[model samples]
Target: MADGRVERGNQTRRAVLARTVDIASVDGLEGLSLGKIATDLGLSKSGVFALFGSKEDLQIATVRAARAVFVERVVQPVQDEPAGLAKVWRLCESWLGYSGRRVFPGGCFFYSVSAEFDSRPGPVHDEIARIRGDWARYIERLLDEARLAGGFREAADPADVRQLAFEVMAMMELANAHSVLHGEAMDYERAARGILTRLRAATAAPEELPERPPAFDFTAGRPSA
Candidate 1:
């Protein structure tokens, strides 16, 4: 039946997307190829081509797939946290764990791929830009939540807090790149502690600094709403 065919096609599409994200993370989108994907997954060349008519389509699908995995692994976990300084810390912690555990094998997929595609222009590049914008907006929203919670001073601009969030994320990505290249893990831990130090300085009153934990357990599930 045509319906059966459609269902089977959808299954194959999902499988392809799963593999695509992992492969593209390490190899870059341009390095993604039908032959390689098919060979890795043990699928026929025609079958892979049937799901994605061209390489570009496969690349786009890979980005979409990576987005899904990212949300499940990172965003969804922190979505229900009460928005404030706590939520901002939750976001940073989640990202560190996401990278620490090697969720993408090659590290943060967006961080790795975005740099690879930054100067390039196309639908793929557009999608990367959109993802980055979404993340920045989310950080800004967290800063707004902090202001609403009185966690931040009234004079603090949400825009400025968002920029600070980006700096922390950049440090993590830089550490990830170096760690992956050198097989070292200490930088990841240092990056996390450095972020916490900056956040404490930002949020704490002159005499109300928080104590540092020996190790942050970023792997914990999101706090229930």
Candidate 2:
């Protein structure tokens, strides 16, 4: 009986988090309420409240859950790829696909939530900021690794890994922003092409990346393999 009860509670928690992530992505974490989520999920308000404890706690958990989905969708695929210019390019490609395919319904979960909470001061804002910082650091680390692997040209300013990562990340965020606001993915192609140009200029192996942006069926909401 004890084991069964625990398993059921875990299932309920997962169910609540799944709904909360999608809802928070589109509406921001401040939009979440225990009562409304309980009503929508047909679960008791007290039960949902018991699992999360407070509105802020629920929002924090939702952000954490969205980060997990982001990792699985964008970061994990190229995890084992050689840590060189190719890996960096592939990682950016994954991010574009994740956004273009609407993995979060609002494009990038962090992008929407970060803009919502960027100026606000609270635990939710801190959580979002920390995760975003982690992403920036991750890109910077990849760029450093690529340089060590001799993936960059001598005259390409490979020493400025931070700037490269910054530019790449900025382009990606713009893609997500434009796609969500305009309901079109023109920015994805533009970002992809722009990034490829930057990467090629940095690396001696220009052939390692596509000459053009990867083909995508934007109407079908798919990015190329």
Candidate 3:
């Protein structure tokens, strides 16, 4: 009986965090309140507070929740693909898809929350920075893997590949903004083409490279969140 009660509590906490992440994605984390989240989820404010302790705790928890969603949606899918240039390309596609699909309703969760906490210094900011740093490192690791697989030119520098990863990040964020503000799906295609061009330039065997995948079509319907 005690185990059942503990399991129920854990489930409720997960439910709260899921909703909290969505709300934080749309409105900055600063906009979150225990009372508001409790009301939205039909739970008691005290119950919510009991789980998170304070607003900062809740904000940090929300960021953690978002990171889980990001990994499931963006990272794991590409990891399932074979490593090398293909994996790297798919990683770029999945990221664009994640943002284009509006998985968080307000666009990329990290991009939105990072902008909010970037200038602020605290646990929340630190957590966001850690997430960003970890992602950058992941990109670099994929580039290194591709290099070992003979995907890139023998002369390509790891530092240069890391820089290319940063360019891909910039294009993705720009695509997200353009899609959100102007509703231009073409921005996603442009970003994909730009990434493809960059990758092709680094290709060790241009003729042996796989054909590029079609750009995501946002006009049809949003991908499942």
25: Cα error in model 3, Å: 0.9
* Per-residue accuracy of model 1 over 1-225 as CA lDDT, tens digit each: 999999999998998888888888888888898988889889998999988999988888899889888888888888997766767776776777787667887888998899899999999999988988888787778877776667763467767777787787777788788877886666776886787687776773423333552464434432212
Model 2: residue 85 alpha-carbon error in angstroms: 1.0
TM-score of each: 0.88, 0.95, 0.93
- 75-190 in candidate 2: lDDT tens per residue? 99998999888899889988998888887888899999998999999999999999999999999999898888888876445449999999999999998899899988788999
Question: Largest TM-score belongs to which candidate?
Answer: 2
Q: What is the full ranking by TM-score, best candidate first?
A: 2, 3, 1
Best-fitting candidate, scored by lDDT: 2
User: Local error of candidate 3 at 12, Å?
Assistant: 1.2
Give the lowest summed-lDDT range of ten residues in model 3. Answer: 216-225
Model 2 residue 27 CA deviation (Å) reads 0.7
Residues 1-225, candidate 3, lDDT per residue (tens digit)? 999988888998999988988888889899899998899999999998988899999999999999999999899986966657767877888888888878888888889999999999999999999999999899989988888777886677788888888988888899888887887778887888888777777877666444554757554433332
Predicted candidate 1, C-alpha RMSD: 3.5
Model 3, CA-based lDDT: 0.84
Colliding residue pairs in candidate 3: none
Report the Cα lDDT for residue 110, model 2. 95
